[model samples]
Target: MFKGLAVLLVFQLTGEIIAFGSHLPIPGPVLGMILLIVCLRFRTSGRLVEDIERTSSGLLSNLGLFFVPAGVGIMAMVQTVQSEGIKIGFILIASTFLTLIVSVWIFIQTRKVVERHRETQ
Candidate 1:
Protein backbone atom coordinates (compact mmCIF):
# COMPACT_ATOMS: atom_id res chain seq x y z
CA MET A 1 0.00 0.00 0.00
CA PHE A 2 2.78 2.39 0.91
CA LYS A 3 4.65 1.62 -2.31
CA GLY A 4 1.51 2.12 -4.35
CA LEU A 5 0.88 5.45 -2.60
CA ALA A 6 4.43 6.54 -3.23
CA VAL A 7 4.08 5.76 -6.91
CA LEU A 8 0.86 7.75 -7.11
CA LEU A 9 2.37 10.76 -5.33
CA VAL A 10 5.51 10.64 -7.49
CA PHE A 11 3.44 10.80 -10.68
CA GLN A 12 1.33 13.62 -9.22
CA LEU A 13 4.44 15.57 -8.23
CA THR A 14 5.97 15.05 -11.65
CA GLY A 15 2.73 16.27 -13.27
CA GLU A 16 2.57 19.28 -10.96
CA ILE A 17 6.16 20.19 -11.75
CA ILE A 18 5.52 19.92 -15.48
CA ALA A 19 2.27 21.88 -15.34
CA PHE A 20 3.75 24.61 -13.18
CA GLY A 21 6.91 24.90 -15.29
CA SER A 22 4.98 24.94 -18.56
CA HIS A 23 2.05 27.01 -17.21
CA LEU A 24 -0.49 24.58 -18.66
CA PRO A 25 -4.19 25.21 -18.05
CA ILE A 26 -4.87 21.56 -17.10
CA PRO A 27 -4.76 20.51 -13.45
CA GLY A 28 -1.70 18.62 -12.20
CA PRO A 29 -3.73 15.75 -10.79
CA VAL A 30 -5.57 15.31 -14.12
CA LEU A 31 -2.27 15.07 -15.97
CA GLY A 32 -0.98 12.73 -13.29
CA MET A 33 -3.99 10.43 -13.88
CA ILE A 34 -3.21 10.36 -17.62
CA LEU A 35 0.43 9.55 -16.89
CA LEU A 36 -0.67 6.80 -14.51
CA ILE A 37 -2.93 5.30 -17.23
CA VAL A 38 -0.06 5.23 -19.74
CA CYS A 39 2.25 3.65 -17.16
CA LEU A 40 -0.36 1.03 -16.23
CA ARG A 41 -0.95 0.12 -19.91
CA PHE A 42 2.78 -0.42 -20.39
CA ARG A 43 3.19 -2.58 -17.25
CA THR A 44 -0.13 -4.42 -17.20
CA SER A 45 1.41 -7.73 -16.11
CA GLY A 46 3.62 -6.34 -13.32
CA ARG A 47 2.94 -7.29 -9.69
CA LEU A 48 3.42 -3.65 -8.69
CA VAL A 49 0.73 -2.65 -11.16
CA GLU A 50 -1.60 -5.23 -9.67
CA ASP A 51 -1.03 -3.78 -6.21
CA ILE A 52 -1.70 -0.28 -7.54
CA GLU A 53 -4.85 -1.55 -9.23
CA ARG A 54 -6.09 -3.08 -6.01
CA THR A 55 -5.44 0.15 -4.10
CA SER A 56 -7.13 2.23 -6.79
CA SER A 57 -10.14 -0.11 -6.93
CA GLY A 58 -10.57 0.14 -3.14
CA LEU A 59 -10.49 3.95 -3.29
CA LEU A 60 -12.88 4.13 -6.25
CA SER A 61 -15.33 1.77 -4.54
CA ASN A 62 -15.73 4.38 -1.81
CA LEU A 63 -15.52 7.37 -4.16
CA GLY A 64 -18.91 8.72 -3.05
CA LEU A 65 -17.40 9.59 0.33
CA PHE A 66 -15.19 12.14 -1.40
CA PHE A 67 -18.23 14.13 -2.50
CA VAL A 68 -19.53 14.62 1.06
CA PRO A 69 -17.40 17.71 1.62
CA ALA A 70 -18.73 19.32 -1.55
CA GLY A 71 -22.30 18.51 -0.55
CA VAL A 72 -21.71 20.03 2.88
CA GLY A 73 -20.19 23.15 1.30
CA ILE A 74 -23.28 23.55 -0.87
CA MET A 75 -25.48 23.15 2.17
CA ALA A 76 -23.48 25.89 3.89
CA MET A 77 -24.30 28.17 0.96
CA VAL A 78 -28.05 27.54 1.24
CA GLN A 79 -28.95 31.22 1.31
CA THR A 80 -27.05 31.99 -1.91
CA VAL A 81 -28.56 28.95 -3.52
CA GLN A 82 -32.04 30.02 -2.46
CA SER A 83 -31.57 33.47 -3.98
CA GLU A 84 -30.55 32.08 -7.36
CA GLY A 85 -32.35 28.76 -7.12
CA ILE A 86 -34.70 29.33 -10.03
CA LYS A 87 -31.92 30.39 -12.41
CA ILE A 88 -29.71 27.54 -11.32
CA GLY A 89 -32.55 25.06 -11.60
CA PHE A 90 -33.44 26.30 -15.07
CA ILE A 91 -29.84 26.04 -16.25
CA LEU A 92 -29.47 22.52 -14.93
CA ILE A 93 -32.72 21.29 -16.49
CA ALA A 94 -31.98 22.97 -19.82
CA SER A 95 -28.46 21.59 -19.99
CA THR A 96 -29.62 18.08 -19.08
CA PHE A 97 -32.28 17.99 -21.81
CA LEU A 98 -29.89 19.53 -24.32
CA THR A 99 -27.26 16.89 -23.51
CA LEU A 100 -29.83 14.08 -23.82
CA ILE A 101 -31.02 15.33 -27.20
CA VAL A 102 -27.46 15.69 -28.52
CA SER A 103 -26.46 12.26 -27.20
CA VAL A 104 -29.46 10.55 -28.81
CA TRP A 105 -28.79 12.28 -32.11
CA ILE A 106 -25.13 11.24 -32.08
CA PHE A 107 -26.05 7.66 -31.12
CA ILE A 108 -28.55 7.45 -33.99
CA GLN A 109 -25.98 8.78 -36.48
CA THR A 110 -23.31 6.36 -35.20
CA ARG A 111 -25.74 3.44 -35.42
CA LYS A 112 -26.61 4.33 -39.00
CA VAL A 113 -22.93 4.43 -39.97
CA VAL A 114 -22.32 1.09 -38.27
CA GLU A 115 -25.28 -0.51 -40.05
CA ARG A 116 -24.12 0.87 -43.39
CA HIS A 117 -20.59 -0.47 -42.80
CA ARG A 118 -21.99 -3.90 -41.89
CA GLU A 119 -23.98 -3.99 -45.12
CA THR A 120 -20.81 -3.15 -47.13
CA GLN A 121 -18.84 -5.82 -45.34
Candidate 2:
Protein backbone atom coordinates (compact mmCIF):
# COMPACT_ATOMS: atom_id res chain seq x y z
CA MET A 1 0.00 0.00 0.00
CA PHE A 2 2.75 2.42 0.96
CA LYS A 3 4.72 1.65 -2.18
CA GLY A 4 1.64 2.13 -4.32
CA LEU A 5 0.91 5.45 -2.65
CA ALA A 6 4.47 6.54 -3.18
CA VAL A 7 4.30 5.63 -6.85
CA LEU A 8 1.13 7.67 -7.20
CA LEU A 9 2.72 10.67 -5.51
CA VAL A 10 5.81 10.37 -7.69
CA PHE A 11 3.65 10.45 -10.81
CA GLN A 12 1.81 13.49 -9.46
CA LEU A 13 5.08 15.24 -8.74
CA THR A 14 6.36 14.41 -12.18
CA GLY A 15 3.15 15.82 -13.66
CA GLU A 16 3.41 18.97 -11.57
CA ILE A 17 6.95 19.51 -12.75
CA ILE A 18 5.95 19.01 -16.38
CA ALA A 19 2.96 21.33 -16.08
CA PHE A 20 4.98 23.99 -14.34
CA GLY A 21 7.80 23.71 -16.83
CA SER A 22 5.51 23.72 -19.89
CA HIS A 23 2.89 26.17 -18.56
CA LEU A 24 0.08 23.86 -19.65
CA PRO A 25 -3.56 24.80 -19.18
CA ILE A 26 -4.44 21.52 -17.50
CA PRO A 27 -3.99 20.93 -13.77
CA GLY A 28 -0.98 18.97 -12.49
CA PRO A 29 -3.09 16.32 -10.79
CA VAL A 30 -5.16 15.82 -13.92
CA LEU A 31 -2.02 15.34 -15.95
CA GLY A 32 -0.74 12.94 -13.35
CA MET A 33 -3.96 10.89 -13.70
CA ILE A 34 -3.41 10.76 -17.44
CA LEU A 35 0.15 9.62 -16.94
CA LEU A 36 -1.01 6.97 -14.49
CA ILE A 37 -3.57 5.66 -16.96
CA VAL A 38 -1.01 5.39 -19.73
CA CYS A 39 1.44 3.63 -17.46
CA LEU A 40 -1.22 1.20 -16.25
CA ARG A 41 -2.24 0.38 -19.79
CA PHE A 42 1.30 -0.56 -20.81
CA ARG A 43 2.31 -2.26 -17.59
CA THR A 44 2.61 -6.06 -17.50
CA SER A 45 3.04 -6.59 -13.77
CA GLY A 46 -0.10 -7.88 -12.15
CA ARG A 47 1.18 -7.33 -8.61
CA LEU A 48 1.82 -3.64 -9.26
CA VAL A 49 -1.59 -3.23 -10.83
CA GLU A 50 -3.24 -4.96 -7.89
CA ASP A 51 -1.42 -2.72 -5.46
CA ILE A 52 -2.48 0.38 -7.30
CA GLU A 53 -6.04 -0.84 -7.42
CA ARG A 54 -6.04 -1.45 -3.69
CA THR A 55 -4.56 1.96 -2.99
CA SER A 56 -7.03 3.66 -5.30
CA SER A 57 -9.93 1.87 -3.66
CA GLY A 58 -8.78 2.95 -0.21
CA LEU A 59 -8.43 6.60 -1.29
CA LEU A 60 -11.82 6.65 -3.02
CA SER A 61 -13.55 5.06 -0.05
CA ASN A 62 -13.00 8.24 1.95
CA LEU A 63 -13.00 10.71 -0.93
CA GLY A 64 -15.39 13.07 0.89
CA LEU A 65 -12.62 13.87 3.34
CA PHE A 66 -10.63 15.38 0.49
CA PHE A 67 -13.34 17.98 -0.07
CA VAL A 68 -12.98 19.40 3.42
CA PRO A 69 -10.17 21.73 2.44
CA ALA A 70 -12.17 23.08 -0.50
CA GLY A 71 -15.17 23.59 1.75
CA VAL A 72 -13.03 25.45 4.25
CA GLY A 73 -11.57 27.61 1.52
CA ILE A 74 -15.09 28.45 0.34
CA MET A 75 -15.99 29.45 3.90
CA ALA A 76 -13.00 31.70 3.98
CA MET A 77 -14.29 33.45 0.88
CA VAL A 78 -17.86 33.60 2.09
CA GLN A 79 -18.10 37.35 1.91
CA THR A 80 -16.89 37.51 -1.70
CA VAL A 81 -19.15 34.65 -2.69
CA GLN A 82 -22.14 36.26 -1.01
CA SER A 83 -21.64 39.52 -2.92
CA GLU A 84 -21.44 37.73 -6.30
CA GLY A 85 -23.40 34.65 -5.33
CA ILE A 86 -26.31 35.17 -7.70
CA LYS A 87 -24.17 35.77 -10.75
CA ILE A 88 -21.86 32.92 -9.86
CA GLY A 89 -24.77 30.59 -9.18
CA PHE A 90 -26.42 31.45 -12.47
CA ILE A 91 -23.27 30.82 -14.47
CA LEU A 92 -22.62 27.55 -12.69
CA ILE A 93 -26.14 26.27 -13.24
CA ALA A 94 -26.27 27.35 -16.87
CA SER A 95 -22.87 25.92 -17.70
CA THR A 96 -23.73 22.64 -15.99
CA PHE A 97 -26.88 22.14 -18.04
CA LEU A 98 -25.13 23.18 -21.23
CA THR A 99 -22.34 20.73 -20.59
CA LEU A 100 -24.81 17.93 -19.91
CA ILE A 101 -26.74 18.66 -23.09
CA VAL A 102 -23.58 18.84 -25.18
CA SER A 103 -22.25 15.62 -23.68
CA VAL A 104 -25.47 13.75 -24.42
CA TRP A 105 -25.54 15.06 -27.97
CA ILE A 106 -21.97 13.95 -28.55
CA PHE A 107 -22.69 10.53 -27.08
CA ILE A 108 -25.72 10.06 -29.33
CA GLN A 109 -23.78 11.11 -32.41
CA THR A 110 -20.88 8.83 -31.55
CA ARG A 111 -23.28 5.91 -30.97
CA LYS A 112 -24.88 6.48 -34.36
CA VAL A 113 -21.48 6.52 -36.02
CA VAL A 114 -20.53 3.30 -34.29
CA GLU A 115 -23.82 1.69 -35.33
CA ARG A 116 -23.26 2.67 -38.95
CA HIS A 117 -19.75 1.25 -38.86
CA ARG A 118 -21.05 -2.01 -37.39
CA GLU A 119 -23.72 -2.26 -40.04
CA THR A 120 -21.19 -1.67 -42.80
CA GLN A 121 -18.94 -4.37 -41.32
lDDT of 1 at 35: 97
lDDT of 1 by residue, 18-115 (tens): 89989999999888889999988888797788778777887799999999998999899999999999999999999999999999999999999999
> What TM-score fits each model?
0.68, 0.78
Which pairs clash in the backbone of model 1?
Answer: none
Give Cα distance to truth, residue 113, candidate 1, Å. Answer: 15
The lDDT values for all models are 0.90, 0.94
lDDT score of residue 89 within candidate 1: 99
What does candidate 2's lDDT look like per residue over 1-110, in tens digits?
A: 98789889988998899899999998898899899999998995888888888899999999999999999999999999999999999999999999999999999999
Q: Which lDDT value does model 2 have at 7?
A: 85
